[model samples]
Target: MIVMNDSQYHQLVDDAFERIEQTMDSDDFDIECDINGGVLTLEFENRSKMVINKQEPLHQLWLATKFGGYHFEWHEAEQQWICNRSGNEFWSLLVESITKQSGEELSF
Candidate 1:
């Protein structure tokens, strides 16, 4: 596991959130994104929601979807957030979860 200082971890996670927000902004999906208190919430048209938040103490990112919850840790070598349990990449799993919930395909 790679060890990141507090500032570095925050910056990396914040950047990921910003990227997600930007992607949502440019897409035509009916998902609404709101970030507050370092938590990103995505509300879909069907009233389902997905949440992504940073786990500062663990230096990990957490995501909750209609299906289940996932914990992701930053993989410094791959430069991606990878689920600790499933070993799925964060963005890919996120897009998959969104598609499953919203019935629309999205890439981020």
Candidate 2:
């Protein structure tokens, strides 16, 4: 597990959101994330009901919505998100989203 300070965690979250926005073609969509209360909340404008939270103890993060629930694992060595217990594709989407938004490639 790669241990990061609070600042690094915040940066990762910001980078992830940037990627998500870039991947979306719709102009009416917006995502807001908050990292407080030992959790990270991702809120979407178009789909208000679609919200995701990443809680502390960081290894065990839970994602929930109308679709289903996902339990994620963070691979620090790979700097990737893993969801073998659910849809693994989400990690890619997030990465793509950040990349698209930043218009830059991520080394991790």
Candidate 3:
């Protein structure tokens, strides 16, 4: 696990959210992206929702999808968020979840 201060973690997450939003904006998918109170929410055409939020105390990112909930911690070496239990990378999981819910393939 990488040790990151709260400011660093928040900066990383905010940058991530910006990248995600930009990607989504460039795509023509029926997905709505919204960020409020530091939480990112994606609402699909089928009415399914995925939430990505920061866990400040734990220094982890939490994602809630229709499939399940996953927690990811930053891995400095890989420069990616990785699930501690499943060992899945955050971008891969996010793409999979969005495809599953929206039936549209998206790259993030």
Give the best candidate by lDDT: 1
What's the count of clashing pairs in each model shown?
0, 4, 0
Total clashes for model 1? 0
3-39 per-residue lDDT for model 3 (tens digits): 9899999998998889889988898988899999779
Which residue segments of model 2 deviate by more than 4 Å?
25-48, 56-61, 84-89, 92-108
TM-score of 3: 0.96
Error of 1 at 11 (Å): 0.9
lDDT of 1 by residue, 17-55 (tens): 999899889989888999998899999999998999999
TM-score for each prediction? 0.97, 0.49, 0.96
Candidates arranged by TM-score, highest first: 1, 3, 2
Model 3 residue runs over 4 Å out of place are none
**For model 2, how does the per-residue alpha-carbon lDDT over 1-108 read when each residue is reduced to its tens digit?**
466666766566556545544544334335555555445445555434334455545644455555556766566776766675744745665445434443334332
Model 3 weakest 10-residue run by lDDT: 23-32
